[model samples]
Target chain A: MVAISDLKKISEYEWEIPQSFRADMRVPVRFFVTRDLLEQALRDASLEQAVNAATLPGLVGHVTVMPDMHQGYGFPIGGVAATRYPQGVISPGAIGYDINCGVRLLGSQIEAEAAKPRLDVLATALNKYCPSGVGQGGALKLTERELDAICVEGAEWAKKRGYASDADLRRTEEGGRLEGADPAKVSPRAKQRGRPQIGTLGAGNHFIEVDVVEEIFDEEAAQVMGLHAGHLALQIHCGSRGFGHQICSDYVRAFQGAVKRYGIQLPDRELVCAPLDSPEGQDYLAAMRCAANYAFANRQLLAHWARQAFEETLAGGVKNWHLHQIYDIAHNMGKVEEHVVDGKKLKVCVHRKGATRAFGPGFPGLPAEYQKIGQPVLVPGSMGTASWVLVGTEGSMQRSFGSTCHGAGRTMSRSQAKKQIWGEDLRKELEGEGIHIRTGSLAGLAEEAPAAYKDVDAVVETVTGAGIARKVARLVPLVVVKG
Target chain B: MFTLTTTYQRNYKGSVTWGVGCDFQLEVLPFFVGIGKIRYTGKTMVTETGYREIEHTADWELEVWAPNLSSLLETAARGMYALAQMQLVDGERESREFEIPFGDRESLLVDFLAELLYLGEGEGLVMDEFSFTFDGNTLKVRAWGAPIKNQSKEIKAVTYHRLQIRETEFGLVVNLVFDV
Candidate 1:
């Protein structure tokens, strides 16, 4: 474990672990958190993990971890690193197992008051229309040919099928499709696992929430996102499903040797990497993009299903259900982006594992509609807690390469949470808080109890405090559907 | 045929059972270190739906049995390198020490193995053999190997999801489910 004393206080919200601490480190390690939260984060080896990530080959700037950072497989969740493009190494572990495991938010026309009475009906419709749960399969089953298309085109595939709108595709990161997705690079087993799971929410912390926009902090930004105070909204949190998981697993195992071939010495095995220009690195990146596209399509289809469920359950053909895609962003992904580093316009592979891309205004990626307001950052809170909507700031690009916190990070482990809370009782407690939940298993529910996480409000406070992302609105959940 | 029942239960989550058919009752863990017993049977392997099916690996492959999922996974991990005739060294040599941390249990196991590989390659420690103790979620293990000799398989970092280690009445069953 890295001693807390080794952490140099950079600011009230920033702490740094200098590269001098480790000889192999290419960059320093920086963490964003409040003093109290910093203490909690240190309870586990997440800081150590962050420090270890700093030692990867070709890393640039400091290995920056967001406030939501937690111990993850190879890299800590909410971790960010920008490695020199082409020559910099890419670690499958750094990208994570659930590749493109991200959150997408949709805003509807219905107001909170009007939607409250019919919450149960909406929840039931969503649960039925959107398949969720462990080992659950979706209604749409794709053949190998179609699956390959889905992997390649991502949201574009959904748009072609009329499941997505042009506007929806425009607002998504990378226009909802990343470049260089080579399906052939994805193994058959990974394809097999993904073939049946599209449009389904797999188990473990993945959820679909029906929330009411409680408050709008930035009116101009809210208007651009079609979000208003009291507007009913839907937030879908999932990934490329078994497909992404398998792809990452397959590559992480494959790259174990690439580290040696490249003569790279990492502080942790989880940071195993291959040079971006190398054949192995190129193949893994391609495969990772396939998973990213799959996740985009997966969420797009879920949105379609959600709209259908609303139309079926409510009157007026659910015309009141104006579910506009606010924005979809990839949190766990590595993208080759051009950024200014040390007064040089250098291309780098920015890996945002369990972190969100917070591109500010004037970036070319956003649709014309959102170009003025900047990227819509979705920060989903813990179950039964308040989530937030933030917009990227110019300060973000200058500082953390246009990246920000992903969600309310965890404060406790699953076991620790389970030992302290009961599944049945926790259900009752959430319901008492006026949040309705339907879960596949009670134990899973207990493991995800709100107390198991840090306060979303506080985490958001740190980001806004640091000026990386500015608050736009706050969302309070009315009903939740968990897988 | 022998009937193998693998059960997984979370104190808070649901439990699942997977059945495999083999012809043997393996000696459970704590019974022996390297070898275990298997009673051969003639019955067929059954699926969750109760339909019998044919399997090749279970029918003829050699499996090292343990009592729990951790040991099962450990030995399975060991089995991968053991096949290479990797030699074990005494833990007496005081070498570089580092901490391996993971997000979850399965990733923890992967990190454990990766640590051994790193020692073998990075620090010049030839890791041919190792043993581990699971204290809750943390693992502390002793590994043996000569100084870094040459490259073996490039073992990357471990993952956390879809990891399975099951205990059965017959013996321990571990699934080497890798993301890669």
Candidate 2:
């Protein structure tokens, strides 16, 4: 176990565990955390896992961990490791099981005061229109070939099918579609699993929440994103479903032998990896992008369903129930991005497990509207807490590889949360607080109790204080749909 | 788990009795009542097949042991279902047979459990009786189960994070990580 005192404090909100902490570690681990959050991380293996991640071959810069970091399977949840492209290794376990699991924010002009009377109806409509819970299927069905197209084209497929608009694609990361997605590299079993789950909001911590923008920190940025105080915003959080899981599983298993062939050694077997140039690595990347694209399409379809829900519930009730696209971003992914390392610009595969890409303004990928404001970084809090809307800063590009924290990271395990809180009671408490709750399983809801997570405000504060991200707006939940 | 085999004998006779010529790793935890038997620590003994819960902040991890590869797979599956809080209906029983290609014990274990998870997540199926016969890189599984009437949690998928089937003094011990 790593003690808090063992770290070399870089700043009040930053700490370092040098490579000397473990001999095998190729680079030091840099933490974006405050003292309190640092202590919260020490209680779990998040830091230790970060140290284990530091051992990945050919790691560049420090292995950066966000303030909301928590221990996951092999890598810490909020970790970012960039390796030299075509030379360094890519570990699927580090990218996580939920490939491209992400958050999508949609801004609306519907005022909370006007929608308050029908919030219950809107929540019910969302639950009814948008599928949730275990084994839930989407409204749309597709052939294996269509699913393959979605695997390669992502949200662009949705646009072609009229599920998405031009503006929606414009605001999404990588234009809601990643290039180099080769469905041939993906398995048939993975395709079969994905065929019927195109737009589902599958169970376990996944959700569609309706929130009212509670506050605005940066007026210009908030206006650019269409976030106004007292207005509603919708958040969709999920991933590639079973398709990504199987793809990741298939590769993680195949890479076990790859590590031996590549002569790479690691401390954790869960951290199994392949050389970036190897066939195993190239195949996994190609397949991972398929899952990534699939996820993008899934969220796009869910957002379309959400718009339908809004129209069905509030079309006649309000003048504008229309939800406009703010931005969509993936929290779990491995992208080949250019960053200056040791004053040398290099294309490195940035593996962000539970972190957000927070590119500063002036990046070429940004839409024309957001070129001056930087990329939007959505950091959702736990149920009943405040979610945040931030933008990347130049400092993030310089230090953290253009990434920020993902959410109010879990402070307790699911078992611990279940043991400590009752789902029914938590639901009641949240209901009492004016947050409508719709969940598939009461036990599942109990496991996601707000008390189980760290303070999102403090987490946001740390990153903003570290100058990696800048705050734009804050949101408070009005209705939450969980599975 | 000793009780696991005993339960298999009581609940699924055909499966526990199939494949007679295989060594059984017989050690059971203290009344292994689902995931409740686990300690809230990272290193708590499940006490069945030397399987124990390893503390993970987000996902679930179990360290399982057996005398050989086959027993190790069984113990790990038992541990996994326990964590998911899987249960079956009493009157409506069902069974399914599966033929899955395997490369090694690690991949075989992942693919096998992934199949079970798919059944549960897709069709609400749960099984008590299971028979696995491995011929080279193939595993033929004959399983008896019922629709999952009660499941407290749902695991997203099984992962290969440091998954290894090792030969130890007592048996083959390995740690499995499940993405929840």
Candidate 3:
């Protein structure tokens, strides 16, 4: 645990744990948090995890944790680390168990008021049309060969199948496919876990919510994202599901000895890693990409289901009920890219766990349509809370390695939340707030009560104030489905 | 009645465990670890009884059982080592044992395994097995793992949040989520 007084304040919103704090640490640990939130964060093991991450081999740039950060297995949920690409190491633990668990948002022409009565119907239709809530399978059950195609093709595969549009591919990070995804690198067991889950919304913290575009911060950017005040939009929060989870689990175990083989020393076993250019590192990277692609394909399929639900519910009332894919971005992943560190443009693999990619405008990877607006960064709040859509900024490049907070980080444990709140009562509370929810269990609902998380507004404010991302729109949830 | 469906795609074949807790076995790792679904029958709800033990496979023996998915998952955590006959000595037994209460079944599965790994790794306590009872949102779990002479795998931390645990007449089912 870090003593609050030991922190060296960088500003009102940032604090630093310098290298001198520990002998094994290769770099200092930086945290972006408000004064109050920082105090709350100190009560958990997340700070220790961040400090431990600083000790991993090949780590470049200071280790950083976002305000929404919370305790995770090896690294803090909102942790970020960059290692030299070829010589540095890749640790599955840094990426997390649910690999490529990300967020995707779609914009529609329909208005919230116009779709009010249909909200419930659409929710039910979506629940039926799109398999959700624990162990649900997708509409398309891929053969081994087809699953391989998905691992390699990603959202492009969806595009070919008419599930995704060209524009949709254009807006996704890495165009919905991370390069170097070798199907051979992914274990057969991991593949098996992903095979049936494609296009399915696997449970836990994964949700598809209906939102009303309540406010727009940047008019031009909002226009590019197809967001309009009072318009209805759909946000899907899920990822590679069992496929990604299995990949991470498989690799973390595989890398257990790699850390020692590479002569790397880590504070936590969960932080095990291997050099990027090494055989083990390459294998993990390839598998990571496979999981990432699987996630893109998974979200694309869910988008299809959402479209079908809207069409079935609206039934000729709204034409072109297709939910236009605004953008899909990954928060938990490792990407090999070139970034200027200490004035040298070195290729490094950036590991973002529970943090979103906020690439500024003019990056080569973006679609032609969004070149001027920057990458869309989606930050979801907990159940019955406000979610925001933001865009990357130039300041991010200079500081956070083009990263921002992912969501309202956890403020309490599930047990803590459950002990304090009743699932039925919480449901009533959210309903009173006009947010409709469909869940597998009432007890589960109470654990996700909005109070269990930090104020997303404060977390978003820190990043926006830090210039890592500029808020574009705030989405108020109308309906939520949980697993 | 919780219904479970398994789909095999490409090289990937997985199952979704949902519905009452009948799919609890799916929540247990090295047993049925994957995706699957369960739907409540809205019919007869009976008294749920369960049992857990480590089963020996051809190569590796693992803790196995059904305890309404959540408890089964929690037991699986201890089962992983108890199958190896590890015991959590009285001296090493945790005074304040870690419990990861999941909101739903999915997160509960993951959280249960994660807790096992966490206890084994963070505290260096080798647990054998655990029993559980659910009270609304709270999952009361008592886990046991014997101390190992030499440890091979170190379990890390456990998470709840999206963690899942469920109950059904098919014999209590749960998913064990590990951060291994």
Candidate 4:
């Protein structure tokens, strides 16, 4: 176990574990956490896993962990590591099983005060329109050919099909489509799985929630993102479903042999990886992008259905009831990009697992309106709490590869949470607080009880204090749909 | 369940035993080492085939011990269904079979469970009876079930995260971690 005494403190919000602490580590491990949260992380394997991640080959800079870090299987949940491109290594486990599992925020002009009376109706409509729960299919059924197109076209496929608008595509990350996605690289079993789950919200912590913008910290940034105080916004949190799962599983299993072929050694078998320039790595990257694009289209379609739900519930009740896309960003992904480290511009593959990309101002990827500001970083809190909206800063680019925390990370195990919290009682409590709750399973609900996670406000404070991200707005949930 | 003598067995304190009693198996390496042949129970080794839920921090983990590989696979399937809270329908039984080319043992394990998940989600079908046969690296699975009448959870994927299939002193032991 790693003791706190071994850590080299950099600042109140930053700390480091030097590479010399572990003989195999290629780079040091950096911690973006408060002292309190660091204590919590010490109780679990999050920090140790972050240290393990530092051992990956060709790692550049530090293995940066966000404040909302938690213990996961191969990699810590809120981890970001960049590897030099071409020859650098990419670990499928580092990217995660749910490829492109992301959050999409849609801002609306509908006033929360005016829509209060119909909150339950809106929740029901959203649940009815968005097919959620275990084994549930989505609103649209696609053929193999169409699924192939989505692998390449992403949200643009949705746009052409009238499920998305030009403005919606503009605000999305990479215009909601990744380049060089090859459907041929994705396996047939993945295609079979992807065919049926286009807009569905699969089970386990994935959710669709309606919130009211509680407050705005950056007025100009909020206005540019269309976030208004006391107005309604919707957040859809899901991923590539089984398609990405199979792809990752396939590549990870295949890479077991690849690691042997490449003559690379790791502490954990789950951290199996290959050089980016290798044939195996190229194939996995291509397949991964297919899953990534598929996820973009999945969220885009979900956004369309969400819009439909809003219109059905609030049409004629309010002057306008449309949900415009704020931005869609992947928390789990591997992106190839150029970044400056020590005044050297190098291309690298940034693997962010349960961490959001927070590109600072003037990157040229942002929509014109957001160029002055930075990329929107959506940090969802636990259910029935305040979710934060933040943007990247220059410090993020310099120190952490432009990535930040993902959510109020889990502090308790699911078993512990379920044992301590009753699902029925949790539902009643949230309902009493005027938060409309729709869930598929009570047991799952108990597992995700708000008490199971860390303090979201404190996590945001750490990131903003560290100068990695800037807070823009805070949101309070009115309705939550979970599967 | 029939006990196969082909697998290894250990006698401890003159009792039969099988199960992964940990709430969550520690990291991957120590899990197998920590519990191998060093039976904590003063009484041990019942020689029956069964499975148990081990504690996992984020996802569901299961440990299955049997007298052989086929029975271990069966027990692992049952454990997975139990983890997902799968329930079957009355009145009708549905059957599906999988005959596929095999790779490694771990890959075979993941593919088997993934097939079951695919059936459960895509067609609402599940398994009831089990027959796993291997012939020249070809796996044949024959099973029966009906459309899922009720289910509480969904497993996103069967992962290779610290997956280990062991031929231990207590027959064949396999630990599986699932992504939910």
Task: Write down the TM-score of every candidate.
Answer: 0.77, 0.91, 0.76, 0.91
State the displacement of the C-alpha of residue A438, model 1, in Å, after optimal TM-score superposition.
Answer: 1.2
Q: How does residue A468 of candidate 2 score in lDDT?
A: 96
Q: Between candidates 1 and 4, which one is better according to DockQ?
A: 4
* Deviation from native of the Cα of residue A270 in model 4, angstroms: 1.6
Candidate 2 residue pairs that clash: A269-B162, A270-B161, A270-B162, B42-B55, B46-B52
- Residues B44-133, candidate 3: write the lDDT tens digits: 112233222212100122323454465466445544553222334445444334555545565455545645544443355555546677
What global local distance difference test value does model 2 have?
Answer: 0.86
Candidate 4 stretches with Cα past 4 Å from truth are B1-47, B99-104
List iRMS for all predictions.
15.5, 2.9, 14.7, 6.0
lDDT values, one for every candidate: 0.74, 0.86, 0.73, 0.86
User: Per-prediction TM-score of chain B?
Assistant: 0.46, 0.73, 0.43, 0.73
**Model 3 docking grade:** incorrect
Summarize candidate 4's per-residue lDDT along B1-180 as a digit string, tens digits: 332222122211122334433322222321111121232222122335655556666777777778787787777777787667676777677778888568777778887887888888778876867887888889999988777777788887787766778886557788787888
For candidate 4, write residues A241-342 as lDDT tens digits.
Answer: 988988998898889889999999888778899999999999999999999999999999989998998999999999899999899999999999889876
Residues A294-348, model 3: lDDT tens digits: 9998888888878888888986876556678789999999998778788888888
Model 3 TM-score, all chains together: 0.76
Query: What DockQ does predicted model 4 obtain?
Result: 0.32
- Write down the worst ten-residue block by lDDT for model 4 chain A: A413-422
Cα RMSD (angstroms) for every candidate in the order listed: 13.9, 4.7, 13.7, 6.0
Best model number under DockQ: 2
